[model samples]
Target: MARGEPVTVEPVVGEPAAVADLGGERALLVADVHAGIEVGLRYERGVELDSRADARRERLCDLIRETDADRLVVLGDLAHRIGAPDGDEREELAALIRAVTDRVPMTLVEGNHDAGVAEAFADELDVIGADGGVLDGTVAACHGHTWPAPALLDADVVCTGHEHPQVRLEDAVGGSRVERAWLRGDLDPAAFTEAGTEADLPDDPPELVVFPAFNERSGGTWVNVEGQSFLAPYLPAALPAADAYLLDGTRLGEYRRV
Candidate 1:
């Protein structure tokens, strides 16, 4: 957790979630909870799911407790829709935020699915731009739909969640299963220079950490295949030699989306 040294990143105990312990500031980070996802499925995908709002809240609370984190940083897509949230989404998000904030402070990094989220939780939590936030001068975190702030790219490590990175593995029996996973690699320092982002570039580029979707019910892109797309504009180049890991910290080795 020293400056310019790799920060220790790991999944929360007994959860498909992760947290970064940045010496002075500890953060429990999760992404794409997508509250009211059941509603989105009901309308768009023709599937109905019983409201699991309480269950989602409980799961997050449990992770917070397990990690003993001082703060919770949701990477984005806290709600399901792209525009305004519906009554169901609002209620669900409000309940979850209230429950978590009641125990510890929370910070939300805006994402593509978070257009109206700032207003929804304006009074309860701190909302930051999608570009990202710097943590304790060591870690920079963002939602990863676009380019991160230059200052963030210069941090010791940069964490993102918009990819909801996952991997598909096939067994000898001709069966396959998908598991939520983490992607870690170094960013290409030239990307910042080429993009003209105004910041002091590090001698060695910071590492990039892509988180998995916190909600298991959500979908993810297979990251080990050819031409697989990602939401982050600087990715695939920013992280040319990324390695994939399961939520339990199982190393799946190097992967390429293209």
Candidate 2:
């Protein structure tokens, strides 16, 4: 694929979600869709978090249909719990996948949260890998959790959604704050090593592109926190330095490093 211009970030109203348009044929890139996260949060954490998931699904379907995209690429976290797949959750997710697949081709990339559940529904959907899958020419997609292999970076644009990256803002008095900021930056290999659960990352970080999480309950983490590291190794260097775009429903803002 011919090298396209840099990624364009756009936000959707209602749920305050953002998406990247890759300037490709019939493709809408997305990531970090923890399908059953709400159920799990309620079950385990006892947090009665709520969002219009069904409505979001409908809007997403509408977006796919209206955009006339032939494919929907999910970067990762297709499911919530690791290695746990309840029948009800599986059925609900399967139905959602079927609905979207009915409108456009759906591609699922595995993330840390996706282990047994994602594979279980693979037969009903197209499952891509972290190594990368060629979308058209050089355009490739993967879950940015693991270090992207060399081949992935060769693509014109690589899309992944594992960080669930967000920017935190505070008032002058440091009382009021706002989240839901869109994050866009170059891919760095170093940020992946900082995860507390995992130590060490690949020697070279690929040209990274991180996407915000789709699940509302999966709160976004402040990228600059002391020990709260991101799955993408190069995030620290890429962010607040490289091009970063924050979106609020078609409104885009350039982020200045704090």
Candidate 3:
């Protein structure tokens, strides 16, 4: 495949990661890593916990090797500090970045918590705006806190994070549990008109893929739970008739109805 041709992005079964064929180079796509999350929990909520930074970094490295990805694209929130990185957070991030970049080139899409990381490690990664950037001139990747770049809206497909989407399920016995999910739908060209983007709406809109967070410690909105709301401002409204799927790839028609 070449630039402008249809790109391939397939979710890795049972994991919140995807393999994207960036023309001929494969890239691993992950989002909402929230590294050093224990630090944030300790600071913001007065909760103390052990750092899973090592496990998180190793998981990513394993994915890169297993997928044979030529590059790695972090959709957003690679760090947990909402403002700036320092202390244990900075150290963990440094190690994580080094580990991934050592294996393959990496791109970090700016999420709400990533500004400081971008500024601090500008030399180690290809840090793009939170609005997102096109990969291999085909696949579009964004953080989803805001609308994607207009050009990204015109790609073969658009993928994002920030929702950390999960669905609550109930058994016949009334036991319930939450599972992270993938939300996908057709892009509504009319949706971006309000965001003030001048994207040339394609005659046939591309698929809009909402990825789940890679960090299990990151609790997210229970999409199917009543009174729970979507985090992305443009979601639910922008993605009409969106469907939710489990990490195992079981499709539960219509995320709203799941």
User: Against the true structure, whose lDDT is highest?
Assistant: 3
Q: What are the per-residue Cα lDDT tens digits for candidate 3 across 158-252? A: 88899999999989999999999999888786774446655577777777899999999999989887888877877777788789999998999
Which regions of candidate 2 are displaced past 4 Å? 1-24, 188-207, 224-227, 237-240, 249-258
Give the RMSD in angstroms, all C-alphas superposed, for model 2.
Answer: 5.1
Tell me the number of clashing residue pairs for each predicted model: 1, 13, 0
Per-residue lDDT of 195 in model 1: 69
Task: Note the Cα lDDT for every prediction shown.
Answer: 0.81, 0.61, 0.87
1-258 in candidate 2: lDDT tens per residue?
A: 234554444444433343444445556666777777777778788887664457657866887766566677777777777776776567657767888888877777777777775567757777766555656545667676665555554554456677776666666887855355455545544443334534333343334455667666677766544566666654555454443444443323444442
Q: Please say which candidate is ahead in lDDT: 2 or 3.
A: 3
TM-score, ranked from best to worst: 3, 1, 2
RMSD of each: 2.4, 5.1, 2.2
Clashing pairs in 3: none
Encode model 1's per-residue lDDT on 1-258: one tens digit a residue: 225556776767446577787667677988889898898888888998898888999999988887888899888888887878868888888899999999899988999999988986789988889888887677778887877777786578777887877788889999988778888888886663336656666667788888899888888878886667876787767887988888776788897531
The TM-score, computed over Cα atoms with residue i paired to residue i, of candidate 1 is: 0.92
